[model samples]
Target: MRIEKHPILTFERGKEIYFIFDGKRIKAFEGETIAAALHADGIIKYNTSPKLHRPRGLFCAVGHCSSCLMTVNGVPNTRICVTRAKEGMIVHSQNPRGDLND
Candidate 1:
């Protein structure tokens, strides 16, 4: 479910790779960012705010805002928008306290 036939960017589907999110199996392109792939899969809620715990998603789509932050492979405070998706990567939703290692 990609914009394969987009007008601007040439559609060059990359190699498929498997990754896990909250114990769920998900497939992503080799060179795409984790956020992009997740968004493509209809995953909008990335993390919650630290204090208010409000839901946050892709705001800037350029890593400017911390709204798209999530946990990746046990690393906390990872900016999914800028982070590229990799094979066998593990991504998880951040906790309400803004903690991922927990």
Candidate 2:
């Protein structure tokens, strides 16, 4: 599921693309952020806390905080909140140990 309509920002519909997450294929709109796409898909837990292992979501829409960190296309320490989603881009949640392919 994706955000069909947004309140503030007008969603510019873009080309469809497929990406793999946890071995499952998912669709994302072109030029959308990975965090936005995931959030639209009902995925809030982007990463776990390093110490307490508490699930973390998007705190700041910008890339100031480390809350919305995820692995993008096998790259670790990716800030999904700011990173724009592209066609065929893969996004994975980071574990407590900062592992993406766990």
Candidate 3:
């Protein structure tokens, strides 16, 4: 569920758009980050831990952490938390630490 109202913040959204996540179409807005859109669409698992292979999700929304890394349009290790969601963009969940040569 989106936070429509807050005591100290305001939200301004852009036009509606759609992106591919793991071969599934996800609804999003132009200005929202991929992680935000995924979260809004009820997708919480972004990746997995490198060693333990545990599920990972959004940790830092400001692009300062690796917890939100994923593959976007064939580019691996993309920080979806800071990358803006675009129409028809392809996103995929990474495998463990992610592959840079992908």
Candidate 4:
């Protein structure tokens, strides 16, 4: 969920845009991070751990961690938490090796 109104901070949401996530269309705002859009759209599962195959989601919100890694426009291991959401972008959940169709 997005905080539209905040006491300390302000949210300057841009024009609404659409993107493809795992073949499903998702709504997002311009300049917002991909992870933020996904979370706002109720998508919490970003990827799975490479070894144990456990579920993983956004952890650091920064680009320093792999928890938010996923394939964006066929690019694997992309840090979605810091990646800006764009119109018509293709995103897919990573497999055990952090890749889709790899």
- Candidates' lDDT values, in order? 0.81, 0.77, 0.89, 0.90
- The TM-score leader among the candidates is 4
Candidate 3, residues 12-54, lDDT tens digits: the string is 8899999999999999988999988999989998777888989
Tens-digit lDDT track of model 2 for 1-102: 755678898767788876766566667778777777777778777677888988788999889988887778888888988888876677777775555455
In candidate 4, what are the lDDT values of residues 24-91, reduced to their tens digit? 99999999999999999999988879899999999999899889888899898899999999999998
Off by over 4 Å in 4: 99-102
Q: Which candidate order results from sorting by lDDT in descending order?
A: 4, 3, 1, 2
Quick one: ranking by TM-score, best first?
Answer: 4, 3, 1, 2
Which candidate, 2 or 4, would have the higher TM-score against the true structure?
4
Determine the C-alpha RMSD for candidate 2 after optimal superposition of all C-alphas.
3.1
TM-score of 1: 0.86
Residue 54, model 3: Cα distance from true site in angstroms: 0.9
| Native-referenced Cα lDDT, model 1 | 0.81
